[model samples]
Target chain A: MNHALVSLACHAYVVAALVYLVYLVRQMDALATGGRVLVGTGLALHAVALVGLFGAQGGRPVGVAQGFSTFAFLLLTIFLVVDVCYRKPVIGAFITPLAVAVLMPGLLLDPGHVMSPDVQRPLLPVHITIALLGVAASAVATGVAVMYLLMERQVKGKRFGLLFSRLPSLEFLDTLNRRLAVLGFIALSVTLVTGAFFSSAAPGFFWTWTSKQIATLVAWAVFAALVGARSFGGWRGRRVALLTMTGFCLLLVSFLSSYDFIHVGGGAH
Target chain B: MEFLCIGLSHRTAPLGVRERLALPEARQVELLQRLAQSPNEAFLVSTCNRVELYMAAPDMNRVRESAREELQQLGGPDALEHLYEHRGEDALVHLFRVAASLDSMVLGEAQILGQVKEAFEKGQGVGAVRGELTRVCAAAFGCAKRVRTETAIGRAATSMASAAVSLASKVFDGLKDKTVLLVGAGEMAELAARHLKQAGATKLLVANRTLARAEALAAEVGATARPYEELFTLLTAADVVVCSTASPVPIFTKENVGAVGKARKHRTLFMVDLAVPRDIAPEVGELDWVHAYDVDDIQKFVAENAAARAEEAQKAGVLVAQEVARFVRDRAVRNGVPVLAQLRQRGESIARAEVERTLAAIGDGLTDKQRKSVEAMARAIVNKLLHEPTARLRSVGPEHEGNRLAGAAAELFGLEEAAPPTGAGGPNVVANGGKG
Candidate 1:
């Protein structure tokens, strides 16, 4: 039943993403409302599914399917909250589809997977939560950067097509990108700190400096520079958007490299 | 009652004819009042581009003749050449299109809808709008509102000044935070300055070679005047620059823009060059700080405006058609009203005559109480017999079946007066309404 909820939510997110893409090309109130309402419904269903999984697992999600489901949930929650606040559901064209892709592994694959009991350290969940939060924020910023570039091109090139008119102002996208980058940076800083403590305290887990960790460090530096340059140096426009996009690519590399698969019923404890 | 629309638009007439036919406030009230006598309800929408009068009545011939007379009197000899008229559903559709701006000179413009609303309000005040015109206008306004919201019909503004402001908005988030610098006091510059001001540019500066002329233009537009010598300084402070000077050579150079780029932290700048020889150098546009569009480029945008919104406009047109269809179908029920009224009148009179004869045959045995009861029973029998026909005509039918049934009932009842005017109910547009 919980998987059914996840499946339903996934379908809703897919449809919402498509509607938002159409809206990006040709804006209309009905399309925006469709996208918003579907995202809202999917988020509600996904939240309930997550709570059900928590009850079944005694608190945290149990397997790889549950883990990625939780990650996709974080993505949708962050996206919907910020979109509602900023009134920019157009960016959902990028974010909701990514959420659907992330949720697909959990929905399509056989459900059971497990890892070492030590990998389930209580502190690790906190780190995962903060890190996923950072990832979602950075992903949203990346989407906004893409929008900024598209608008900047049309304004510079002077095409003035439907896409040009449908897009929000370049400055608005740039401002939103900067704010999201800073927010991601703050969340990521806490994530790195919490992850370090988890690594040091958990048994059989050590600071090995894996490729994922290196990429995380690199992404963190890029975002720090972005937030720092924007705040102290008053940097804006294309440069900021470019840097945020770069950071997002690095973060993607870290997420994919670090995404470990477990043997089905690997037997915890 | 059938709806009618007659007059001249920019499509059918030139500016001279439109201007000659345009009605002022006083003239509009007088015209509406004159046209709105008992049986006819009228509305007049008089703008610079079009002067159209909408009316509804059962007797369309008399109304059309009066409308032609008014047109001839108001527009003189040219009114006959450019006149077109729409009747019945066609007139209602035309109103829907006009209110949605689909029939505007510049398709999807925002002003026509407001002008239509203003005319409607004036008609309401003049007491010239009743059943049919009121229902049709209300639907027109609703369809306009939906077209505006459900489609991007009004997103593209199609004038040079409006294009500049719209492009500026694409770069900057809003004009309220940006400063606009006008480099000349020409008509184009003055026009763009007013547009920018209307678009909510709080800080506007005018700089021209003739500072006095600049000051006068600035005063007229509620802006500050600056010396042309401080042009580069103004450029540094301003985010949008409009150059309309008559300079033979380029007034600005790439080197000057490159130098000013650092002063403003390379903030995005938009410049519109409206001069004949081009006020700003074309090379200045190559610099990273600015995007400059000359007169041709702006005009190109103007020409592309309608084509760009073609898809959305098509969507709005479909929406308007659907709304018009729904209104027509809803209004078809009213077609049966006259027939039902005639049927009730004939039946009640026949019943009264029959009841009196029967009572006379029954002789003096019938008391006053019995006579009243017999009369009441006769009226009840007529009403009961008319119920099914009335209900069928009023409801239960296909698109045009209600009206057809009503006409058939009128014929069956031998009510000659209930028939509609011949050749008048069909939708028709006559180009030669004005007889000189």
Candidate 2:
């Protein structure tokens, strides 16, 4: 039943992602409504599957597959919330496909290893939640930033094509991207602080700079500079969008590297 | 009733000829009153480009002659040469085309629909349009709306005034919170100002060399008038500026605009110079924050949009043709109404006469309930006997064959003179005076 639910959820996400793509190209209200309903249903089913997986694993997701699935679920949740609040259907075209892509690995790859008992301490859940939320917020920022760049290009180039007309205004997209970046930064800050506590609790993981940690630190520094420039230098529109995109890419790299490192090392302990 | 249209448009008439035929509001009302007295129903639509009269009359030649005489009285012999006439289905198609903007000088212009609606309303007010004219006008309005929604014919701006607004919208997100400044009170500037206001520009400032003219235009447009000397200060506050001064030299140079840009904190500015000699300096457009378009640029934009709409207009033509065919079929079905009404009246009167005779013969022996039941039976028999014929009559097409069948039915039923007589009753008597 759990496997069946997970497969259903993944298929629903793929269908929703395709509908959103069509909606972006056609700018049809019907397609947008259908896509929203599909994504909402998919998110519900995905949450149920996650709950089942956690229950099966003794009240927590225990492996890299589960972790990736949780991250994808959080990403989709944030996307739906933003999409509903903003009424910008165009962003769904970018975010839904990203969600499906992130979830694919979890659905295809079996759980090779589980986390050690020591690593599954009380602090571990808090660290994972904060980190997933942070990643989800960053994903939203990246989607919004992409929209901002497209809108800015159309405005600056004086070429109002179909994509240009479909996109939200540059000002709106820019503001949304900034807000998401701020939210993600705050979440990442909390995650890093929690991770510090968790690392101290787990032996052999204290203050050690692995490739994943270095990549994450680099992504954090880039976002810090981006937020700093926006606040202090009035950096906005195209430049801010580009910086946010760069930070998101770096964050993605860091996430994948951490997933690989943990799985290759037979789960962190 | 037969539909007929007589008019002179830009296609068939020169401007002077059309101007001569143009009727004022009072004159149109007088003509409508005259038409109301005639047996035919009629209404006139007089715009700058065309003056047309649409009517429902029994005789096409009589209505045409009367309309031609009226036009002759208004514009003399020269206007008569430009006048054209359409009859029946052609008239309906013409009205649809006009309302859909297909007949407009600039294809797909929106003003024609509003003008058509105004004429329709005026006709309704005067009781000069009813029955068939009412249905035709309503269908024309529907077709116009369908054409607008189903095709991209009306998508782009075709005039300079609207082109300016379109360009501004392309540059900015929207005009809702933008400020527009008019540097001169020229006709083109007033047009652009009205377009801007319609597009939801929040504030408007008019600056002209003549303060009185500026104030007059300001009052007209519900805007404020700033002194010509205060143009520079106004420029800093405005997001969109329209310049159309009569001055031969440049109104604002590159240096002055650069200074204004500095004061504006590098906010985006759209400038339209409608003047021939170019009101704003060409180099002013080179400034980082300022986007300027001269008259030629606006004209180019209008031309390009018009060309694009021309393609959509072809698509609109197909839609209009489909609507016209549907309307024709509907009108055809309506032609069957009178025949059906007459046939039913004939059958009902026969039933009534038979029921009365039988009731009188039965006299004192029968109960009132029994008499009523017998009468109902007689009426039911007549109704059932006439059912198939009446249904067939009502479904007849407006074609010549349908008319021939209707004539045969009238002859067979002796219904040719079946106009319901006032205060009279018989098996042959019709209902509602056969006005159907």
Candidate 3:
């Protein structure tokens, strides 16, 4: 039943994404409202599925699938919050499709254990939650950054097509990107601190100079530079957008590396 | 009765001739009063581009001659040569075309509908628009509204002021929080400022060479007037700047705007240079964050938009034709209403008289309940008798066939000599006057 619910939620997200895509093309108010409602419903059902999975696992995600589902839920929650606050429906043309893409893996794949029972410290859930939240925030920032670049090109080229008309101004997209990046940076900072504590507590894991650790550190440095440059260096527009996208790509690499390392490292326990 | 529209439009008359025939508010009221004295319902529309009078009268030649006389008095013998007359169905079609803006100088401009409505209201105020004219004007208004919504006639911005607003909206998210700087309080600059203000720009700064003229325009537009020397300072704070000075040279150079860009932190600045001599330097547009559009650019956009709207105007023309047809049919059906009422009244009165006579002959032989049933039966019989003729009368066409059928029905039912109700002449008036 829980698996079925996850599948159903994934389907809802896909439909919502498709509706928003149509809205981007047509720019109709009815389609926008329908997309928002579908996304909201999908989020609610996704939360229920995650809660059921956690309850079955004794109040924690058991494996990669559950971990990915939790991340997708948090990502959608953050996006909806921002969408509601800003009332920028055009951003849904980017974020909703990204949400569907992110949730597909967890919906289709079996969630094999990544950490043995013996190595599961109490801080593991907190570490993973903060880490996934950081990733979700970065994903949102990346989506906004891409929109900024597209809008900038349109303005500079004087294309003024449907996409140009539907998207927000370059300045507005840039501001949203900067804000999301700052938020993601702070969350990643907390995640790193908590992950260090978890590494010390867990039996097999260590904060040594492993490949995954190096990748995570590199990803952390990229975001740190992004936030710093934007705040003090007057860095903005296309340059900042490119750097943000690059940092997000690095974060993806770091996340994949950590997933592999966790599976291999779990064998020892 | 006869319907007639005698007028001169931009197509037939020069601007000088049109101006001579144009009626001011007081003069229009006087004209309507004179028309009311002649027992004809009349409406006068006198805009800068056209001067027209629409009237429904009992005599076609008399109405045309009087309308020509009125035009001759307002204008002169030269105006008489340019005046054109459309009678009956042609007159109504012309009115619908006018209201829908298909007949406007600018193919789909929106102002003419308001002008027509104002003319109608003026006629109503002086009791010159009784019933038929009221219905015709109301239908014309509906037809205009339908054309506006169903087609893209009024969708594009075809004027310089509107094109500027459209350009600004394309650049900014919205104008509600943007600041506008108006340089040189010229008429075009004031018009653009008003357009921007209507589009929701929050702050307006007016700067002119003379402080008093700037202050006057500023007060009129609810803006702040700045000194001419403070143009650069105002540019620093403005998101959109509209310049329409009568200067011989460029007012803002590339260097001046580039410096303001720095002061504004590289925020976007939209500049509209409506002056013929180009108030802002063309090179200023090449500067980062400054987008400058001179008069030629705005005019080019307006012309392009007007051409696009002309295509949509074709669709609106079709809609106006359909609406006119529907209104004619509906008017035909309404024409049958009074006659149908009189026929029913006549049948019911005869039925009641016969039933009372029969009841008296019985002399209380039947109970009160029986008598009541008998009366209801009489009413039902009368209704059954008149239903087909009533339906036939209401279903007649708007053409001569319908008129002939109505006349035959009135004569057969002995209603031809009976006086109609006070307001019952409305449909007859339109039918007679609207038929060629």
Candidate 4:
């Protein structure tokens, strides 16, 4: 039953992604509104699927599959919050595909057990939630940054095509990028602080410098630089956009290469 | 289908004749009232570009002569050389095109529709527009609306000032927060600046070599005057720059604009240079974050946009033609109405006489309820007998002389002696005039 809802939600997100892609080319405001409504429907279905998973697992994620599912849910939730806060609609063309990609494995993969029984339960869940939230914010930042760069190119190149009028203003996208990057950076800091306590409880795993830990710390550093430069260095537009995308690509590699961080001395799921 | 239009538009007449023939509100009402009696319906449309009289009467030729007489009297004998005439379907298509702005001096311009609507409303007020006039006007307005929504005929900018504003909107999305710098105080620069201000570019700074002239023109453009020596300083802060400086040499260079890009953090900048010698270097346009448009470039864009509208207008023209054919067919069908009425009256009378004779032969053997049923049955029989002929007449179109079909039916039935279709002196007309 849980997997079925996740699968339905995954299809919905995929369809919404297609809608946004069509809207991006057509430059129709009506199509943009349709994309927003489609995303809302996908988000509703995804929330119900997560609630059912929460009930079945007693609030603890099973393995990488459930974790990916929750990560997509948080990402979409933040995506919608930002959408409401900023009137820019073009970024959904960039954001929804990421949700679909991240949520696909949750529907297809069998979620085996991923945690050590000796791990402190409360701190582990909290640390996982914080890390997922940070990654979700970073993903949204990446989508917005991509939109900023597209608008920047259209403006500089003087094409004046559908994209030039359809995309948000460069300044608006840049400001949204900075806000999302700062939020992700703050959440990553909290996740790292909580990680020390959760991993040390599993014995001999304290600061073990595993592949996942190394990649995550590196991703965190990149986001830290992005947030710091934008806030103080008057850095904006294409340069920061490229930096955001680079950090997100690193996070993607780290996510795909490693199992859930809760696998403290546990076998790979 | 008896609709006729006679007038001299800008196409056929000079401003001398058109202006002389243009009617004031009182004169339009008087002319409409005077012509409405003989024509059965009349309306006057008098604008700067055209003065036309539209009327629905059975005699298209006689009405055309009378309308020409009225215009010639108002605009003198010179108006006769300029007058053009259309009748029936042709007249209706003309009306629809005029309402949709397809026949405008500036194709797809928006003002003509409102002017047409005003003429229509004024005609209705004086009891000069009704019946066919009302139907055609309604159809014309609907056709105009369809052209507006179904095509991008009027979405393109047609003027220099408007083209610049539209291009700015595409780049900046909206200009409420942007700064615009005007680099000259000429009339052309002020015009473009005023248009930008209207498009919500609230912050405008005007700079010219002569400070006093700059300040005076700045007041007109709703901008503050800045010193011309501080041009590069203004460039860094401005999102858009309209340059019309009368300089022989290029005042801006790649090096200067390139440095400004870094100073402004490579923000998008739109530059419109309207000078003869070109105030900004053409090479400045090559730099990233800088867009340069001169007079020729802007004019080229406007022409292309207008040509695109013209292409869309062809689609609108097809829609108007379809509507015109439908309206003509419907009007032709209405021509059969009076003849059908007379035929039914004749049939009902004959059936009643026959039924009364049969009842009288049976004497007092019938009850009151049976008598009422007998009368209803007789009426039903007559209606059944006339059903096929009525259906055929209703399908008539103007090209087939639906009026002649009505005349033939009347002559065959020995009903009211209707006028011959060759001329329109018809007595069996639905008189609906002088009633608003």
Global lDDT scores for all candidate models: 0.78, 0.75, 0.76, 0.75
TM-score of the A chain in model 3 = 0.91
**Candidate 3 residue lDDT tens string, A68-118:** 677778888888898788887888889988887888877766554444445
The reply for model 1, stretches above 4 Å from the true place, is A55-64, A203-206, A262-269, B1-158, B307-436
Candidate of highest lDDT: 1
Pairs that clash in candidate 4: none
Candidate 4, residues B1-436, lDDT tens digits: the string is: 2777889776787655765776666888988888877436788776656788888875556766777888889989888999988776678888999888787655665656777888888888888876668878998988888888887776653335567787776567578899999888976677678788789989999989999999999887678999989989999999998887666567888998898777887777888876555678878988756778765556444544465577788988998987776666565566677788778888999889988998999889999999888989999999999998888787785453565676578778875465422232245333211110
lDDT: worst 10-residue window of model 1 chain B: B427-436
lDDT of 2 by residue, B1-436 (tens): 5677888886787655665666667788888777655456788877655799998765556767878888888878888888888877778778899999887655676877888888988987887776657778888999999999988777653345677787787666678888899999966677788889888887999999999999999999888998999989998899899887767568889998888766776677889876645678878877756778765555445544465677788888888777876776565444445556877777888889988888778778888898889888988898888888777766655343344455567678777675522112212222111122
Tens-place lDDT per residue, model 3, B1-436, is 4678889987787655765675557888888787655457899987655789998776567667777888898888899999998888788889999998887655666767887998899888888888778888899999999988888776653335666777677667678888899999966667787889889987999999999989999998899999999988998889899887767568899988898776777777888876645678888888757777764555444554466577787888888878777776666566556677878889999999999999999998999899999999999999998989887887776454455566567778877654433452433522453356
DockQ of each candidate's interface versus the true one?
0.37, 0.10, 0.11, 0.14
Candidate achieving higher TM-score, 2 or 4: 4
Candidate number that wins on lDDT, 1 or 3: 1
Candidate 2 off by > 4 Å: A55-64, A115-117, A200-207, A261-265, B1-160, B163-174, B207-211, B228-236, B241-265, B268-436
> B-chain TM-score, every candidate?
0.61, 0.62, 0.63, 0.60
The digit string of per-residue lDDT tens for model 1 on A1-269 reads 88899999999999998998898877788888899899899989988988877765545655557666777888788888877887876778778888888889868766645433444467665676677778878888887888888888887787777667778888789888888898899988998888788777866666777877888889999999999998777688888888998998898787656555446333231
Worst 10 residues of 2 chain B by lDDT: B425-434
How well does candidate 1 score on lDDT at residue B314? 88
